[model samples]
Target: MTPGLLVQSQGRVLPVGLSVLSTRGKRELELPDRGLVVGAVRPGSPAARAALRPGTREEAFRGGVIVLGGDVITAADRQLVDAFEDLQSVLIDRKEGDPVTLTVVRGGQTRTVQLTLDASAFRVQGR
Candidate 1:
């Protein structure tokens, strides 16, 4: 799929379904770490379908708390993800049903997992 698909569908949207944070910025905002952290995984989304895990611990951030220590996304499709935008840029041109390989670190163990983007995972608000 492409952005044209989004234009054609109007309210349909494709999403990874994971609340991801750039640990490089998170060091000052949340963790004293640097990497991409999975804060939460949306149920039934691609991330969830891939069995992705979220952080283990919870801490206050911006007056709200979210999971920490779950999984660190080091890369996607063999491309380095040093920031949230890095991942965004890599996936911007991708569409639903596109296959992706993710490098995830959990409990200090690194592993790769397969994922496929899904447009049905979400919709435009108020649609």
Candidate 2:
């Protein structure tokens, strides 16, 4: 089925449900900013449904944390992430149907979004 169709049948998915590259990879590729770069988004995935675009920098932001050249990801739920791995580790521990709150900086503006984890047909590799 098409990704969109799958999402319609399901609901908001989590872990942002997108294929991402590390910020270091982004820099090596000479891409824009040094942040997690969204590479591909699964069809019917929450990331796809949420309109997270490929090539966008993933950043976590808050008052005391400084992200040099990328967007800031402030928090996930009530937990603050010191690094990308911190966020990934937390998501890894969560199960489908769990809820997550994400604070992100996009276009120099901050937005808080809520998402629900969904079961994917394929498991995330190398988790």
State which candidate has the highest lDDT: 1
Candidate-wise lDDT, in order: 0.59, 0.45
Q: Where does candidate 2 have its weakest 10-residue lDDT segment?
A: 1-10
Query: 68 in model 1: Cα distance from truth in Å?
Result: 1.3
Deviation from native of the Cα of residue 74 in model 1, angstroms: 0.5
Instruction: Show the lowest summed lDDT stretch of 10 residues, model 1.
Output: 1-10
Question: Per-residue lDDT tens digits of candidate 2, residues 70-105?
Answer: 334556675765445556766887888787776655
For candidate 2, what is the TM-score?
Answer: 0.48
Q: How would you encode candidate 1's per-residue C-alpha lDDT over 1-127 as one tens digit per residue? A: 1010011134453322223334554654434343466766778778888888876565544323445667767788998764655567677888888988988777767899899988843343221
Give the Å error, residue 90, model 1. 1.3
Candidate 1 at residue 56, lDDT? 59
For each candidate, give its TM-score against the true structure.
0.63, 0.48
